[model samples]
Target: MNRLRAVVTEIEGEQNLHIITFDCAGSSLKMMGLDLPKGLHLNSHVILGIKPSHVAIAKHLSGELSYSNQLQATIASIENGKLLSNILLHVKESDVQSFITLSSSKRMNLQVGEQVTLLIKASELFVLEVLDA
Candidate 1:
């Protein structure tokens, strides 16, 4: 099962970019102005609990093939050149009918309401900083 989890409470956003606020229920992730990836609709995402082993992959968006743990979350929002995603998210407070984005590809093996467990690492979670090119 996957480990990333999120519930969107308010998707104050538009196509390709938006502010997605969620609750992890495991920790306090209150870092403001998070940088998410692009191509994210409003509801297309997977909250992930990154493990220490996957920390490098999560931060770099690259994973090893042996683990077969290819988790890629939709860009909740982007700043500078970095991408961001919310885990254990909340998106119920605001009434919306946004289209959900399936996984990055057809082979993601994910379904709506499907339970997943993320291999979380303490180092994976951190405050984002925009890198100027």
Candidate 2:
């Protein structure tokens, strides 16, 4: 399957990295990276300009991530609205999914336009959230 590449367009800071917006060839998704240390402002950082990074792939997206450890994505597509579509995910070939588990229905409910996190080792990405919107 062909892959999508997006540029980091915006970043917001809170106690942790609040949100990241990307220009996915005009298609975009918001990704949550890390938690704020102790006393960090949400606007302390600015969206940075850098070459596109494989930051995330949308799979089982719900709404905005709520759990400090969980994220959600909204399902939207070019042709039709994918309501409760089973989320499909793609990642670096070397990344492992053994540790990630989902219920049978969850695995089945995932559909096109759904969202799933890029879940990876922090070392894999040179993260930045400053400048650019």
Candidate 3:
């Protein structure tokens, strides 16, 4: 699991389902969820969590994409396995990791220091923990 410390910036939508936005590493992150935990309000500090497998990489991405979170980052390092590839990315002051297939990594020709876009869906995000402001 990937974890990020963030603060809730905004919240929208009806009961049971909401579009929650957060300020993380100077970037705005959005998450779609069925329910907001009790006492979770705007400005509340929380821990954002996502699975490495859920992260998608895009090269020279253009136009509109359905994914709510698109982070601009650079490949920091890569650990290629027999079937899976572990990618480390540097985004602002944070390091994000992604697990992708070796074939996809080769198809993209990803290299260290190469610019790439990280795509993450709102639904893939989860509130790992809420911290005191």
Best-fitting candidate, measured by TM-score? 3
In the range 1-133, model 3's lDDT, one tens digit per residue, is 8898899999998978999999998999999999996678999999899899999999989999989899999999999999999999988877889999999999999999999999999999989988973
User: Lowest summed-lDDT stretch of 10 residues in model 3?
Assistant: 124-133
- Candidate 3 residue pairs in backbone clash: none
Off by over 4 Å in 3: none
For every model shown, what is its TM-score relative to the native structure?
0.23, 0.29, 0.95
In angstroms, the error of model 2 at 20 is: 0.3
User: lDDT per residue, candidate 1, 1-133, as tens digits?
Assistant: 1243443334454554444544444332221223453433344333433333232122233345333222333323212212221223112221111122223212343333333333223324332221221
Over 4 Å off, model 2:
1-3, 35-133
Model 2 local distance difference test score: 0.37
Worst 10 residues of 1 by lDDT: 89-98
**Rank by TM-score (best first):** 3, 2, 1
**Higher-lDDT candidate among 1 and 2?**
2
Error of 2 at 87 (Å): 9.5
Give the top-scoring candidate (lDDT): 3
